[model samples]
Target: MASPAAPQPGATDPTLIRNFCIIAHIDHGKSTLADRMLQHTGVVDDRAMRAQYLDRMDIERERGITIKSQAVRVPFTKQNGDDAGTTYILNLIDTPGHVDFTYEVSRSLAACEGAILLVDAAQGIEAQTLANLYLALEADLHVIPVLNKIDLPSAQPDKFAEELAHLVGCEPEDVLRVSAKTGEGVEAVLDAVVEQVDPPVGVADTSARAMIFDSVYDTYRGVVTYVRVVDGHLSHRDKIKMMSTGAVHEMLEVGVISPEPKKADRIGVGEVGYLITGVKEVRQSRVGDTVTSANKPATDPLGGYRHPNPMVFAGLYPMDGDDYPTLREALDKLQLNDAALQYEPETSGALGFGFRCGFLGLLHMEIVRERLEREFNLDLISTTPNVVYRVDMEDGSEHVVTNPSEYPTGKIAAVHEPVVRATVLTPTDYIGPVMDLCQTRRGTLLGMDYLSSDRVEIRYTLPLAEIVFDFFDALKSRTKGYASLDYEATGEQSADLVKVDILLQGDPVDAFSAIVHRDNAYSYGVALAQKLKELIPRQQFEVPIQAAIGARVIARETIRAIRKDVLAKCYGGDISRKRKLLEKQKEGKKRMKMVGRVEVPQEAFVAALSTGDSGGEKAKK
Candidate 1:
């Protein structure tokens, strides 16, 4: 017997469309699961399918990480039910698993009615697993707990299923077990999604309204926005207005990405798709903006997303000063794609013209810098990352400092630093080292719990500045790559902090300055001074590198001058003649030291600031 025809790419019926996203910890096989769904739904054929098909960037593919959220539409036909012949269009948004990209996950969750909480059967529940689960729950998304990687020899499906069930408050049988790698039981996951998750509800007769979940800048097509139709219908050639910005433009095209972009006549209520308005400026088409008909707009816009708070700040400067404008333009384009990235123009004495950019975390900053270098072909240098601090001066004045250079010298009152509530999950054996690592970073223990006999969860409140450095790298190394961490900013507290400045040849270089806790200040200064002594080249005259707080020097290193042997030409000369030659050389050296200026090479700054050992990691020693 012949089979029935599959559902079309665009399903106008609200009941027939199911919008959902996959959330998981890093390397838990989210993209792999997405690839399987696209394959099983027949949206992608065998010859064209590949691993991590949803991750579009070359960097993402190379690093085996998902930095951006990708939305795709797939059609699935029911196999065994009273309505077995019926088909449904499933909109799957694949999100990044890293803690830095939580903003992306939150945005994706807002558009979906359900989320697939994916966990590795071998690793079980991780820090990000709990973090993302809380986010999904807060969004009121119907979460389907699924244990992946069951095909692996290390798979412990039964044990993890109970843990997952306990976490989600569901029975073990309700927790679906699937191997996203081998495509086993993937159909059951899709079936469970359709049966358990609620379909989107929107009014078809009302004025057009859609939520702009995400957007990207295309070099040829300008801005391509991904939207979820919440009410009414949006068709081609309809003039649209942005409810937040009050900007209007004609919709040039409307389409759905069924593994690829295919043109459609209209995107109706409860559908997820892309829209093209030919808007060139990235800032104009903001993420979380409401899109509505220009002639007949909705009464009120949908509740837009909260602006992301950047916890880490760093300065990005072009190696070639002429590329400053190019860097600005690149950041603008990148900001459209990554709304969480924030930047503003700032001039540095050492690095020249650049922008002090804010990111959610270190990974986000690294990805942004890499994207600028690769995509825009601009060589950039980033200063050491720091957290924002609120400084109260003696004269009853306040200053917010992001860079160490901005820290006030006359701070006579209190300095408040940002703190985070950190959560860590690890095996029972590594609990001691984990706690020790957190304590060394000046963390206060909040709580601890045993997930099972073998796994445990630990919580702590740590300063943001501490974790922004090498905390994650340290945690992973200490635990032998078995621990996972997730943290949330928990307001600020007044702390005894001091700004340590690096001075070369009696002149302070603002790029190497850092704000550190009072206790770590001396070590930080010593480490920075030692690092500079190695990185800076020898000059004609001796150069002194000093780390100081205000006028008091805490650490110092001398870069010895390259001395030319003035007596090298003297062979069996008289004592007075040899003495005269040495005196002449000494006088010349003194004059050179008085008149000459030591030039700190650009590579030295980059090397000293970029290395992990140059920061708090070495201060720990």
Candidate 2:
């Protein structure tokens, strides 16, 4: 999205430019640290600022977390330091700290030359800190250790910094201490960034080339892509073509964020900015794709671009059947901003038409669903979140299953479920309970180590399905909120799985079909039958809800028939007459519905699969 022309007061010089991103564990104050740096550089007015100012979405602020990476250009004028008399163009990328958005960190790091590794002094080194530090190293970015929250009552910067230094292979004195809340020592972070973080260097070329790190869609202005110019320059006159998709468009505007999009004459080499292509289709300007001048195209696309792989799948159906077109439009617009989100139209016999969407993780799935309902104002019903399963059939072929209906029938070979390597950081006191919980979920202990005197790091290999539901919540509850987890899919392994079907009355309902482990099938089926019984209202006839595997029924429950007011019309005529009429009505009920279809409420279907707070609801019965 572009507005009237306005550029920040500064000279875009490559030699004085620093492109870097801030990385931290959740709740460790990365965004607050970013706000302090912005104030120090005079990019954001302190009086007009809000807390966690970098988070743009309402959900982000409400949750007190950064869900997306925000970019801004800061002009740091060093007056009394080693770099005095120099005004550097610092491009700061505020990255999300949660494990679900690790790919976001990777994308931001691809466009940066260095990173600020922020850690909490009170909490010390946690799970995400180690995970993110390794990601930065993998990207070969320079890392400057910054210890934050030194002002907290429990702050112990010396100890945490020492531990951090040991992990990064540096001296303890190299770590910088800062208090983001009080804006203390934040300037030191800026100075250290300029002095320690090297300036960005671009390929020597006159042909225009830029990398699209992220993008967002605007209804009025079309797709606005965020890009970092790697070589040459991008201006209003250039004809741009995406290297990956090959869709060409004329550049309408080029500008810098300065937090908000501001127009500029041009974005030159080694400069971070935005590109307004007026390209409505988001697929044309995908993240990690190279945007090059169509007339003078670059011989090769930019390196280090990997296609995003979504880890979770769920079916999102509109509450009303006629809203299918509206849902499609909303998804099209939503996917423009989120390149990692994948969606395709799917049909379910019970739920009708909907889309089977893929997400990076559970949080990603939640955010997408919330946005669809709140932002797009569409009522949606989501199925149970499932990991992609691999089915090895007896025909000597392998197939992937995204929906329960896709599960192969009469399989003779084997079924393989996804598995993940989970890392848990918790206090030493809670180690026993944590390990016990993991083992019960069919987890295999990989290793464990003490990070500090009272904190321990535990690693385990768990079935991806086990953790996809409420594993994080259970871990936190067991550790009394002292635990943080980070996980990555390792691969797939042999699993004994069966498709449990839910039959209403006598007919099977496809919406309640789930592929569960064989050992848990009976209990799971019983739970499903009980839950469905509660959700389905009593009709004229007793509705039999049964959970079955193959041809045999495993568990069954029934909703008792509602006693109609047949005696109301009797008017006290005769005791024998009333008895005969009641008997006739009871016999009529048996033949009236003849195992007809049963209707279930949306809430019942959701509560049956929802995790976290309502996990105990299904097992209650």
Candidate 3:
């Protein structure tokens, strides 16, 4: 077993520092490659090593995906080349590959000088691979294309290498091929990183200025902010000010993660490390905020990241009313780490206290809810997810509705819903099925192109609401899991959308309300009404579940009443006696039906809101 090397003298020298991130499609061997790099650099010993070494969260480990962008300072000593025997500080950020975590990828790109565009040798280039490459190009980072999984029997490294080279505008021989599984040619990756990636440039003598790329809340240490020192240096015990919030805190600890936290006296220019300020409040340490010395602040804070626009919105209510405050606190902590999460206090008539939270997508919403339950230990019920909509009033005012209950009541001129331009890469045989799926979801064909002889790229403009749920699942099923999709918001368009409200026993259940397109309203109502009937328990009297739009009822289902055995006493008596007992029972049942309220249980809401039904019928009002 071996220990990681300590920071050598001149380790923070701008010329010796290389900041780069691995960007690729999901499961394209980014994390595995990162592990090999760590092993090759001797940052982790055999005893401390595990798969997906950069992913720390239990949920991430269980799902085998990179949800967060993890940074590690690997000290790679060049073995062969003109720079042989030279140790370079490599700040490697492992970014998420899912479309939902695009913001994480963007943030990581901003801090890096170059990116390793990884592609699966067997799977070739997928939709997310192109998406990430464009993002890196937009960030103006130097890109080194690499192909992983070359050892697999199905891998066509030569074919994919040509594809990668063509995509990157490089020669076919320029693409690096490696098997991350067997750790072959991984050293080549490190050597190429040092030779190709541009060194970070910054002035070390100026006032301290660092960009907070990420942050997390720890119960013991409070907020731990991860920053990339852009200019000057940050020293331990220095009072640092958050340039955005104008709040100041003393840096209790400054350290670098050499796959493990190692204390550092100062993080100089071109270095990446974490800073603990012991500030309990999460809002004070925002991602993208600039950290500067309080006494001699930099004249200008670096350009910060754009706020992520939440594409999906949902309501999260604690199952127990008493857990509301705990849920709020938990969300605050999560928001500090996931800058894309947005939430506000909201109250539902049926579900009681909760927050109206916005997420980047359906997966993002699911992950946030899981974190609330697993990490915070709170029982939560999340309403069906929906996209934000804008309602134009006849009075010339407009309102934005994230929740169904917030839909305008007055005369509405029109409702504009968010739209996304989706790109799908699939085999030529699956193009017809893919097109059919998109068309059924109210998609308009944008264009199509032949990426290769057998690979085709299809583009469509679709309503965000249509693809938020089940779309990906349906696509995978239709394509036999051979298609990859990526989408981005493409503004909004006025549409014939109506709010569908679900009423139980003539009272509206705010938790089950959703806004749907006019053409699909009847079907959505019918399906939701049917789903509620199966979920809601039978009451003393018959309960009628109705789905309505405004004052018009579109669909209804009835839950039969629990019969009382009033006739049991007269079982052996005369016919008149039995008739009288039945009549009395009917009268009593009618009276109870008139006065009784349907006490829908919390479990009913949770079950109905869950994605158990067709995505089209999700309660997304």
Candidate 4:
């Protein structure tokens, strides 16, 4: 990368202000680079600087991933020029790279005029790098390709630069190389931002047209919406209206984030900042809504504004009935910060009252679950996560099924499940294991290409169900942590799928039911029965643990009745004494004849999802 001289900061004009985001795959040093930039700008002191400075949550730091999009404003001084002392307000929005948060990335990119396309020097480009690079290009933003982690022992900056140039249509030699860990060549990054990337640009309208990219709730001030002003200016004294929701409120504060919420009297066009709208519900102050003055509103909302929809489905049930309201409160609060989550009231005979929740993907669901338990102090259990499937009955009517319990009671129909297109980048040695894992999930190979002598990229079309359960962990294990994958929706497909139900003591256990292909139903049923046998404890009388599809039993297991110890009449080992002891034992067995309902443990549900092999390998959350 060229260490160009920093351009002179022009007048206090919005055109000189650069608003951009650092986009990359997971663990590619996006947050670390953000911290370094903050440190260089002096917004954060050397002693205050820590790993993932912009990551605000404990879960994010613990998991080493960014869950939410965060933005910060920095002051940068120019090198040698007529306007050297003038400081430019640099707005940087840090986005998550996980496939689950792709929608978040798109919204973040839509708010920026340029992006630093960061890649790990050693790992090269993974699946998400290609996914997000296309998104950035689709937005028609300036992409400055850069490589990080250049100080590692196995650093291969030249090779990754060549691959990135070939794949993303950039010059290999021009790709910047720097070690974010050591702060080497860090100033060049700032120089490139000032010289190469363009300032934020927008509409010609005089009316205020701010695009609301993200929003969250504040306990004292209500909802604070993060936005990038496209035209005109926004002020705390003005009455603002959301074009999408038509909710108007008085703006209480307008400010930029210097890693914290700092107030300003007003924010101008081509600048990124936040506004506090005294709206109670966070949904009303939505992401992608247009924020404008009520008296002088914009004619239209900005392009690419959309509501987040549910992609993955699960059931969240509270352990105690008293916690039902608490659970709803937790979800409502969580929804204030996360627009991607969707939930509705649902009831279960086995587990009592709960909610049916929807998320963007598996990781999104896991994060929500963790937050509920850790943040809210609630005891909850989530059922097996499933994808939305379209069930076409023999009558030609179709409906979507989110839960196994919601499947049709009687049907002669076809089921179409959600399918995903996955891009897997792995080393050459683990090709067989990766292929076998995908094949077992009923995936169809799309294409393959060797990026270098040691690395290859393979694409496949697989069912979303297969990918949701332990596929990522399996891929990492098989490849010794060398494989990284990302997936996108490719519509749905018809499959010979059926619902498998588990019965305890001749009664159906609704939560333990699952949807599987007809060909694998018997095998899956056997696995479920065996797993239940081990998980469910013995009762006074015999308990029949059965796996059935409707009324037909495919597999069964019997927990033998507890035998009584009788030895009072076995004295002297005589035949009459032995007969007396047997008679007493028979009497004791008659007393335990009334069979009680068997109690199934929570582990049974988890163990039932371990259907791939008979060895009972549990699925990951």
Per-model TM against the reference = 0.96, 0.95, 0.97, 0.91
Model 3, position 41: C-alpha lDDT score: 82
Error (Å) of candidate 2 at residue 340 is 1.4
Clashing pairs in 2: none
User: What lDDT tens digits, residue by residue, belong to model 2 across residues 1-621?
Assistant: 112222342246677788999998888889999888877777677677788888989988877878889999878876555543567788999998877788888899999999999999998888889999999999999999989999999999999999899888899999999999998998788888889888878754578778888889887888999998888887776788888878889989888888788888788878889988888876677788888899999888888467778888999998889989989988988887777889999998878899999998878888888889988899888888888888888899888999888877775598888898999999999999999999989999999998888889999999988887878777877887778888888888988888999888778887788889999899989987887777777887888888999889999998998899888877856699999989999889878778455667777767665544322211110
Give the runs in model 3 whose Cα sits over 4 Å from its true position.
1-6, 9-11, 80-84, 612-621
The model with the greater lDDT, 1 or 4, is: 1
Model 4 has an lDDT value of: 0.81
lDDT of 3 by residue, 447-538 (tens): 99998889999999999999998898889889988899899998999999999999888899888999999999999999989988998888
lDDT of 1 by residue, 1-621 (tens): 122444553445789889999999998999999998988887788889888999899888978889899999887776655666667788999999888899999999999999999999989999999999999999999999999999999999999999999999999999998989888989899998899889999998889999999899999999999999999989999999999899999999998888799888899988888999999978888999999999999889999999999999999999999999999999999999999999999999999999999999888888888889999999988998999999999999999998889898764699999999999999999999999999999899999999999999999999999998788888888998788899999899999999899998889999999999889999999998999899988998899999999999999999999988888888995889989988988899899988888898888888888944322221111
Give me the runs in candidate 2 sitting further than 4 Å from their true place. Answer: 1-11, 80-84, 571-575, 606-621
C-alpha displacement of 79 in model 2, angstroms? Answer: 2.7
lDDT per prediction?
A: 0.90, 0.84, 0.90, 0.81
Candidate 3 has what TM-score? Answer: 0.97
Cα displacement (angstroms), candidate 1, residue 141, comes to 0.7
Residue-level lDDT of model 4, residues 1-621, one tens digit each, is 212223322223776788889999987888899988888888888888788999998988878888898999887775667654545678898999888888889888888888999999988988789899999999898888999999999999989999888877878988999888888877788888888778876553489998888777777888778888888888777999889888888887788787677777778768778888777785787676788889988887777456666778889988778999999988987886787889999887777899999998878888888889999999887887888888987887887788898888667578899898999999999999999999998999999999888989999999988887678888888998788888888888999888898888788988888898887899988877887788777766678888898899999988877765566535566687777777877776556554466776766555554333211121111
Which window of ten consecutive residues has the lowest lDDT sum in model 2?
612-621
Worst 10 residues of 1 by lDDT: 612-621
